[model samples]
Target: MKSRKRKIQAPVGRAAMLSLQINMLRDECCAVAAQLMKRKTLDEVELEDCARLDDALAEAYRILRHTVAKVTLARLRRKSRTRQQ
Candidate 1:
């Protein structure tokens, strides 16, 4: 007879997905920052590209930071509620 066991599932929550996207954006920002730093001064095209990347990175981090804070708060609340019972 074969034993039955359930397979472990990876996180599929919004926060989890956002965390992944945040990491991808972080890597992209590093690449863009390195490319920009290599040049003494940005040309018009490079300046525009750098500006867009900077804005994107800022927005990504804002959302990521908020999501992480919310998750942490929720976990703490759960723990406190259990302890109070």
Candidate 2:
């Protein structure tokens, strides 16, 4: 028997781009973990490590989301002021 290969696709658009990146990151992480499980044996301890890494990735993503929001709001405010002139 042979295993099958799969391809992952990402979504498009500006506002949805962030979401796509996050989803891709998660999918890649899971793929890596799945491959590891197939090649090497992991105890519960290693599984916990993977979980921790996923949590950290999520936290970093949240910070990115906040930064994007702040920058976007600043740009909108600047544009609004220009229109008032």
Candidate 3:
């Protein structure tokens, strides 16, 4: 028996374009977090930390939903097809 590896293909068309945009957006998100952390006063830093974390978690959830929605949809479609058969 021979061992084999499967290769993953790069996304095409709208997916590729959207991936590029997402990459840029992710970088911007990092910059925003860094900026948020640069506040001076003790109170300001604590408030900024809390605010930044809340915003970051929300943003993460949104990004996860967007990307994972595609996977979930594909899985559902496959399951539907199986049921049809």
Candidate that would win on TM-score: 2
The sequence of per-residue lDDT tens digits that candidate 1 reaches over residues 1-85 is 9999987643436666776776687677668767877888856576577668767867876887677777777878988999999
Q: Pick the candidate with the highest lDDT.
A: 1
Number of backbone collisions per candidate: 0, 0, 0
* Model 2 C-alpha lDDT per residue in residues 1-85, reported as the tens digit of each score: 8998886532223534775587678677777677668865666666677677778778867776777677677778988999999
The models' CA-based lDDT, in order, is 0.73, 0.70, 0.63
Q: Provide the TM-score for each candidate, comma-separated.
A: 0.55, 0.57, 0.42
Error of 2 at 16 (Å): 9.1
Residue 70 miss distance in model 1 (angstroms): 0.4
lDDT value, residue 31 of candidate 1:
82
In model 2, state the lDDT of residue 61. 74
Each prediction's Cα RMSD? 4.9, 14.6, 9.2
TM-score of 1: 0.55
Clashing pairs in 2: none
Models sorted by TM-score, best on top: 2, 1, 3
